[model samples]
Target: MVNSFISGLAGPLKPDLEMMAICKVSIPGLKTGKEQTSEVKRGRDPIFNQEFFFDHVTIEDLDTKNVSITAFHHGGAKLGKDLLIGEAVVPLREIRELNAKKEVKVIEEIKQAIPK
Candidate 1:
């Protein structure tokens, strides 16, 4: 699930701009999957109440898998002109640990800076 986006201070190449986010999950030895949220127009801070689900996946499969959430800025309707804001990669081991401890419903916030 994608919760929100908070833009960082403007830089030479990355300005404080409007954007959207996408979340992708992949099992290294299995398959790759992705999901996206709607664009938040002209927003430095955006909120997205979205969730994604994968079928036929087991907890064991997640042990070696990864989740990546990426943010993007649109550059008009032009092709191949989208700007990459940032991305966060989460190892499933962290999730598995939480699940093992029966903390699956706990709200945890992870702060990751956008890549320059």
Candidate 2:
């Protein structure tokens, strides 16, 4: 699950607070898998209670795989563009270590993505 919070952000807050959470899994020399949660309504803090899974992920692949969770402001039809708020990346190895210690949850601070 991905929880997005962008309080204290610069600039005026957009009227439409709809937001989406995306999860992307990447492995070297393999096709990437992406999953996204339905848009949520929250001015600055959106909690996405969801799960994403990638099939055929072998133990060997964990060494070279990473998971990226991203949050985007879903501009409605009027804007026609989704704005990226922030994202966090986690290596599979770190996740493995967490699991070994019976720790299944991790909180990674989202690093703001520079707007294009």
Candidate 3:
């Protein structure tokens, strides 16, 4: 996964489709600038997100449990726009770490990280 992120971010994608997925994700720049995609595909439709964005800051840490979905977003053409954050959350069916001492520990860690 790290390799995929590094390679896709560092150089051109070779698999074409993956490259297209990487290309589909963009950041703030000239033309059609897009916020970097912190998307993490899981075993569901809504999908798991790693980055969370607020109006002014970006939450890059992957916190898939409490990730929120913006139903309607405004701003943008007025005074810039809100942070392009991903909603990180831990789905009910998420896989647990084999070496996790306790599942609550990881969840607690994630909860502590999510912004208020």
Could you arrange the candidates by TM-score from highest to lowest?
A: 2, 1, 3
Ranking by lDDT: 2, 1, 3
Stretches of candidate 2 exceeding 4 Å from the true structure: 1-32, 96-116
Question: Looking at model 2, which ten-residue stretch has the lowest summed lDDT?
Answer: 102-111
Q: What's the true lDDT of residue 78 in model 2? A: 73
lDDT of 3 by residue, 59-110 (tens): 2222222222221112246535443322222322232331243534666678
lDDT of 1 by residue, 1-116 (tens): 22233345123434554444332333334453544345556655555444445444445555566666666666667545667766777776665444543323332212123233
User: How far is 67's C-alpha from truth in model 1 (Å)?
Assistant: 0.4
Model 1, TM vs. native: 0.53
What value of lDDT does candidate 2 attain over all alpha carbons?
Answer: 0.48
> Cα RMSD for candidate 1?
10.7
TM-score of 3: 0.18
Best by lDDT: 2
